[model samples]
Target: MRTLLQAVLSAMLLALCITATTQANERYIVKFKEGKESAVKAALDAQGAKLALDLPKHNAAAFSLPAQALTGLSHNPNVEYVEQDAKRYLMSQTVPYGIPLVQADQVSDSVTANIKVCIIDSGYDLAHEDLSGNRVEGANDSGTGNWFTDENHHGTHVAGTIAALSNDVGVVGINPHGNLNLYIVKVFNADGWGYSSGLIAALDVCEAAGAKVINMSLGGSIKSRTEDAAFAAAETAGILSIAAAGNDGNSRYSYPASYRSVVSVAAVDENKQHADFSQYNSQVELSGPGVGVLSSVPMGTALVAATSVANHDYLAIAMEGAPTGIASGVLIDCGSGEQQCDAAGKVCLLQRGNISFADKVLACEQGGGVAAIIYNNTAGQLNGTLGTTVTAIPAVGVTADDGAAMLLDVGNDATVAIGPGNYAYFDGTSMATPHVAGVAALVWSHFPLCTNKQIRAALQQTAEDLDTAGRDNYTGFGLVQAKAAADYLALNGCTAGGGNNTCKGKHCR
Candidate 1:
């Protein structure tokens, strides 16, 4: 039986398709009044609350207090508000097109060991080869077991997009530099579910660990006051929060992301258009490549691959297995009325046009074709699925350029090989969120002196404005541009090109 995630992927695959934390430790954000530092500590110690973070900048501290002592801690005269730390889970990446689209490739040389970016989601896979040397030890789990391990693959994927190593194999991250160190904060469990308190605890841990940026790919419809206070406090402590603008394809807002304190990111495809499912509203601050993004998955999993073209290698997604390998053969165009073209024992190539993906593959199968390769007639790579049609021939998708090149070499042989180290395509505002986070890391790493507010301004002011010019709901300030933001920061110090100060609101977070 297919799980809900699998079922959702199936429906989206047909459309080109598709696409936390720990528990425990009664977490609370104890905000203290001015000059109440010693009193705050005494209250925390008296309540037996283990201090997780000491935020001197915000005059507050986060602690894991016993649930029974919550009332007493709240009654403290110096304590401003003691709220239960909320839980946030891993939102689930693709070389992801957003990387290059946002010009992250241009700033590869700006590596920094001092810039710590926290992925506050499902913990990470510490053993991931691509993430080696880029991770910081001593992950914060908020009392959840399994510490920094990513059982859900979502956190690992998000981590890969932000700072996958500059290795030869696997997907490269937005910031391929070796300097940016990733700190994992596991708030969600193996099931990808978490609470508000857990998230608050993770934020405390992030600030304590000296994380300059926090990337949250997960979100919920309901907003928690405790969660808002934590985020607001993190902002006050000079930590930039980036989040996904929901994936419901509606105007309804999601917490943390929709909060004014965090930078909300929307999803876009390779075509630089709004994704069908990406949520939109005034809260959306920016956009990134989120559709059919190809990136790293966990190790030992079945990795997808293909080898048929000469000059260029295409990221092929296997929709249906062909059982046996299809050796080189004359490519026959079996599109539209030409379904009868002698595809017997040959690799049938079809262009995405009038017929449905299933119909095209069925045509190839009917013609005795050993395999089928469908290339997109339009821009971007083909990501169509054949539903559940059990065709004897294997089917795969290729980019429009690769298909055109293959057409030019109609007589050349193509090969389809299935092996390990699988790369996948996923879609969501969750995927877009990391792109912005990564770009922010790149800029912040380049200019360590820039405050979190300045970093946010650089990103928003220098973004590639789309939709209705200035800042729109769908594309926000347009797609995030790493080099552009970096250049802006270097030249203007968070000031817009028009010489206007972009970092205005101190309480916007």
Candidate 2:
């Protein structure tokens, strides 16, 4: 009898909780009959409903009202069907690094707000602090999973790189002030993987939602006719699609990116050279900062950067194979070993060359070293791959200058610490794609009347020519230049100098 009474009380409590949650707030976008917005507003006013936003172009108004008021709305002679306003959540965070590089700060937020960019990837984490209030209502093409919440951090991170809030606390986006709304189309699952069919569906939805640009950071090696057709249709509808060239670091084609309808973006390092992990091919359209690219990540897991040799701070990239911990010790120079060296319990400092990066780390492990710091023999910070996993210790790469400084430390202890950071660094064409996409939106927002073709041409014409002059496979048309694109649009209008073709000789049709 006691157990039965407790169960009954628990059931009642659950019911109350459910009712409270369901009744909290209800919002809807109500479309009124053509030219009857005033009548709709009057009707809403009679029911004491709150108007959230007025959409004269769509003949619609977003309202917060009770069930009784909603019923009253349907009875109005001028009323059209109402849609329940979808709930959108925040996802990820970002810090400013790529924005100044592209000179996107020259433009204001009000200008960018006119452009709506659709991010077709995993769901967004609506709870992310930096991404608060950046979402707009669009189709959730994730099929079974909820599209508003991002379980996988990839989409959220991409969103941050494109448009993280400009608040001084976190990273500023390319168009940080621009009201460029992000329409998330959850094409991937919780594990950061998706099918081409899902992506195709997302494109259809983005087309209907009036998205100006589509950023696809996910791709597969195989080609699908269904996906290609969908991309072509999106292009026909005047949506600029930008995608990652793939991370294979080869000349092979990666589908969707390889599709002619899309602008296939390749990745470049800080030095404006092709990243070692970035893919290359004739299909490449442009390049953006990919190596050591910093952006937002899921909450709790931080991407910390704190390393010093001989008390002088220097930038370091923590190796993916590195274990989770702080490492500190007297830096011991490990000369090119044709023989085994004594590096027991100390931080082994290895110079680049003499052997592969993996073998050097292996040697450190064999000698019972606590950590391994590999410095570049030439220049720049080393971003080396160990080829395989090592459980012995944490490893990282420092610049040649830091490496030389460590070598000079004959007595002092060289400290290396790895822990949580608000931001993280990632590499690949995936990172570069967002930079181009964000700049595209920034340029598009400035000239909202321009067709997608015009925007694409503006981006291409404005890119800083890299490598060989003109377009090339390695660096595409060169790195994407945001300010130059905007300037071109302002000076040339939509069409270029020749006839009605506003796209600098590129065919619009």
Candidate 3:
């Protein structure tokens, strides 16, 4: 009886050990010796490893296997090396700096005057706090979902740039007073793409809704004659149409924007420099702030990180994939964060470079850091992302100047807070499109009696010419200026250019 009981206990123990070992699987990339790919794969298969990816060109294969099996695999003559399969992330969006750059802030609140601007892109987030207060309406042509709920954040971001509420918490749009009657026509689905037929149908919806300006921050390489006819008709109907000039950074023409009837908007940086990725062509009509443009995304999908030391708040941007929480501790400098330091129970202040943001944050967390702050090695802001690497501590980025100042105040109590917020930074001519559209609405509201052609002419004439001086392919007539365009119209009546004086009400007072 004693022998039988001992045998049972031994079997139970062995089963538990094997189960634990099998559950401890981790993903890794295993490189094989030249001409030994098949042998290495077979050996890995014998070790109970599951193959994930096969890269014959690089002589590598990704697998998920027991951590204990790594040693034996590395010893195989066919195996070259084994390393962890690291994660990668998309480029993160940043804050909006285009409002004042495009002179939208200089326009008066009365300039809004209930002008209707239609957005045709991904669906809008009707529930967004910054957008919920506005008189917004929409219709869904894409087979995705409802027009009010945005599964993809592109439309919501674009809408915020044109009309986010002037609420103090989140971002404020060009028409910040919530005065414009926004008509959203969701042509693009959650995949960030749509058919040309869907877009033309959306134009019909815009016209029916009585929208005076249509913002099309989307395009394709192929130009459809039917789509061109639709835009031309929309233009003839006195509706101002604005579109992105593509982000290809080439001279190739992008549809809709390339059409004669549409205002093609190119992207420029904060300093009014043409973006390298912004397409340059004779069709480009105007330029606006597009690079690092901060605007509203879906609520809770993004956040703004705030950092402060000794009651001094410094401008900061949250690292992508950072946790939403607050971490406060004594600040400790961890130069480059390449090597571990005495960061235990403190906020680790690391300088950017020499390693990935994830590695730096990992080193801090490994050393028991309560939070992490990475300063730029260069002059501009350090916008870093952690990919899929998650940490227990909060991580934020600051400008080089702020980072330098913080380095001097080491050992001070600092706080890094990232919580629920709705704003994000996005780059592309898609971002520039909204700026021009919003400016058009703002200027048109003041000159309601002016024809669409007249308003278009005023904007082109008043633009701050950039790049190759007067009307070049890069920046066209240059940056769209809200106050300048408004001033030009005020000085010259609607008939100053050519169109008949359609004045009936108070004319450009």
lDDT of each: 0.71, 0.71, 0.81
lDDT, candidate 2, residue 236? 86
Candidates ranked by TM-score:
3, 2, 1
RMSD of each: 24.8, 21.5, 19.1
Q: In candidate 1, residue 136 scores what lDDT?
A: 67
TM-scores for all candidates? 0.67, 0.73, 0.74
The TM-score, computed over Cα atoms with residue i paired to residue i, of candidate 1 is 0.67
Q: The CA-based lDDT of model 2 is what?
A: 0.71
| Evaluation by TM-score, superior candidate among 1 and 2 | 2
lDDT of 3 by residue, 1-509 (tens): 00000001111111221111112355788998899988877877887888998887899989887755676786788888887665342323222579888788898756565589999988899988789998889999848788898877888989999988776546788888878889988877667888889889999999999999999989988999999999999989999999999999999999899999999999998889998889999999999988777777777666566787665777677777777566667899999999997887788999999999999999999998988999998765666788889787778888889999999889887877665556666778999999999999998898888889888998898899998979999999999999998887777777753588745335654
Total backbone clashes of candidate 1, pairs 3 or more residues apart or in separate chains:
24
As a TM-score, model 2 comes out at: 0.73
Candidate 1 lDDT by residue in tens digits, 300-335: 342354646443445565553333233434467675
Winner on lDDT (2 vs 3):
3
